[model samples]
Target: MSDAQRICLGAIAGAFGVKGELRLKSFTSEPEDIAAYGPLESEDGALSFEITLTGQSGKGALIARLSGVNTKEQADALRGVRLYADRGRLPALPDDEFYHADLIGLEVFDTGGAPLGRVKAVLNHGAGDLLEIHAPGMTASVLMPFTREAVPTVDLTSGRIVADPPEGLF
Candidate 1:
């Protein structure tokens, strides 16, 4: 899919209750806002769903109901399905904030314009997001902390990032 078309907001964990309720794992900064983007579509664009937040559940997930999902078995069948919203439906971010989708695939470069790698993914595990760069000439990908000190500049227009990685992290 083209990067401009969609942004993955979350996944359907499974059916929450018997009455079509789904366990939604939201990837938004405000978990509850996942429903505001309107109907979410499957990756293949074959299926689409409108989310209605019923309430909050364990692990900060939301118990939601999707249109056309009425049975526990039906919801169970959607487990592990990633949900995406149209790019235009999402709100614009502040200057310093960026959607992970926008960062993925951006090229990475050192201060001297040396190619480092391409961004494979952006990860956040309690700490801020880290840029997982798929550097060539390396056995494994490099995990560079996505901090201002490390990633000094991100030029989305150029589709590249200028990084001042920590010593020996290149």
Candidate 2:
């Protein structure tokens, strides 16, 4: 399936125990909700599995079992494997909210309509989301806060963002 049709919901952190249980880091608003999206597929769509949440790890990650995964070695092999759910299976967000997948690749512009860059990624480091922008002719990308003041508008239909970055942050 195309990436635009899927939404990455979690990743396997490695084997949780000697069993086939996996340490899953969920990217959903409610961690447990990751399992509610039906079967998930790998990034390349090479593999697909239905997840069963068995428990929660000490670190708050979900402990899950994939349909065919058995034994620690099997789970270990899936370490770092990202899980993607079909976009249609996910709950729709309010107009102000967006899935990170939808934000990536969107064109960014200044309030005056000057082109800034395209969104390279959306990231969060325990604080809030930041939009990584890849501007033309720049060796390094810029990280702009994804806040109301910094990003005044996100037009999904137009595939564009209107950023009002903080002082000196282009």
Candidate 3:
């Protein structure tokens, strides 16, 4: 029932051409595989879409058509909506890999067990995922590199992360 358990696959960028085609921005590693996960639901779980990839576009994004969307206006209307899939449908990750959703709510702590913060989000702007941790008593959130050196341990079952943050990052 918790929407937090789902992984965002992509988003509906609204209708592409006038023939009901959609502009889909895939968030998957293999961009074209967005359709392979089957129907994706809206964040609020209010709507579901069945996507069929038609072809690729200029920016590594795909032009697709959805089951119910058929017009450029319709596609444009859905421009910024994010799409999500059931967590179970996603492929299993390697031992050292993890989905961003799995780390979002994990408690962050120092090597000495001092509470630091909770993960607010994971950001990846080409290099790698960064853990955005939000802690009490701090005016601003901290952006910690999610690498093995900085975040040494991520125990999902325990809902906690042990971070060896850089000096002054605390």
Best by TM-score: 2
Per-model TM-score versus the true fold: 0.92, 0.95, 0.90
lDDT (Cα, tens digit) per residue for candidate 2, span 75-163 = 99999999999899999899898999999999999999999999999998879999999999899999999999999899998999999
Which residue pairs overlap in candidate 1's backbone?
none
lDDT (Cα, tens digit) per residue for candidate 3, span 48-99 = 8998889977766799987788777877888889999998899999978888
By lDDT, rank the candidates, best first.
2, 1, 3
* Candidate 1 global CA lDDT score: 0.92
lDDT of 1 at 168: 95
Q: Give stretches of model 2 more than 4 Å off.
A: none
The candidates, ranked best first by TM-score, are: 2, 1, 3
Question: lDDT for every model?
Answer: 0.92, 0.93, 0.87
Candidate 2's displacement at residue 111, Å, is 1.1
